[model samples]
Target: MRAASEILAVWHAFDDFPMETLTKAWHYRSGNEPKQRSVELMRLHRERYGSSGNCFDLALWLIDAFRREGISAYAVGHDLLTPNAHVAVAALDGRGRAYLCDLGDQWIEPILIDAGSGDFTEEPLAGFVSGARVALSVRDSWLHVVYLRPNGKRSEQTYDLRPIAPDALLAAGEYSQRLLRKPLVERRIYTETEVLHWELGDDASYLSGKRGRTEEEPMRSLADRVERIHRHTGMDRQVIEQALTVYGTASIQFD
Candidate 1:
């Protein structure tokens, strides 16, 4: 029973979001214009969770929060044998337009896919999850990350694929079947200056450098990052519309 206020409180504590983005998000909720910047959302989420929030827990908290708010969403189970506990959110309006939103990357923008094809109108900043192939596409807004398994001659499939750690996924191929039983997904997000190492199950941990150093000033706060992302890409009205189109579907409608 996660409350929306509890979630917001977390965002407030960590100071994850910049003041402007935080202000804008609230505006979107209140029928005002929302800004374009994933870092703002990320920072806001961090502030909400304080220090206790990790990637998986934050995801779980979001699921519970969405359910409480009467929103529709699901966590893609990993496999038939064992499923990943990670979750992604989806909502649809009466017009048949659906939105699938995930806070798993630097691009805070909700990706717009055709629901039937695994194609993207705007490609994500990150690469595809590999080693294990999972398909999560739907006619509605809910897209799944699917994995296939051989059933007799043919194959049976499952839709819950969590983000795999790049190294573990690659290593799993070389290891014995017994040793490869554990799931591995790369839970990382790379910005211009920082590479956040998310826990295997948690997606929203504090960002750190990958190798030598990470850029500090640009990412010091969520506001700075949001402004930077906007400046770098020159977020236009079209991008804003796309994001609104996705979030606007969150409203409830009756038949």
Candidate 2:
């Protein structure tokens, strides 16, 4: 069992707070790599406070920390086809046999959760003095969770969890170091949201235009924009740009 301090440390490392620091870290640039907004947030945190790990860094550290705490954790790669990002440790027994003890897995840690998948499950990760029912969903084969906050506002979180041998991680790590060259495909980031998968990259597709929107107002807004563009548009290019300016670049093309 991890001590209170260690658990708190893990929480502190992962909590998405102090937007300024997080902004820099999220946007930090390395060499010729493109700017990542999250890196900016992280860099700000590192500069002002000292050390703060991004989701990937946090997972790696968590695996190491769990190992220190006597858990035989191993890292695993996610899906081969999808974005399939993130990593976590596998549970190993005394005889070195590994089962699906993905408790420490970062992408789908909730699966390791002790409670049943029902109405009254206690979720310590809910971050509330009192836990709430965190709903789960899938998109592009990725899993996600939705829940209400203390203020009654709702939000969602995404992640992946994988099961593999310790040797698999060592091999994957070595392969990346030796062979793979693409940064986006190479460096694993712990963005495990099912929604994000449908919204990222060239193949991104929306189940509907309303995949991300939860209410009618936004949906109507989308409808209104599309109607206006259809009724009186100089060209699709201009309409698309107008949509981009209002709803974002993805909104224009995601159908």
Best by lDDT: 2
- 56-122, model 1: which lDDT tens digit per residue? 3334444555556555444432321222222333333223333444443221323333454334433
| RMSD of each predicted structure | 18.7, 13.6
Model 2: C-alpha RMSD to truth? 13.6
TM-score of 1: 0.31
Candidate 1: where is the Cα deviation over 4 Å?
Answer: 1-49, 80-85, 94-96, 104-107, 113-255
lDDT of each: 0.32, 0.33
| Residue 253, model 1, lDDT | 20
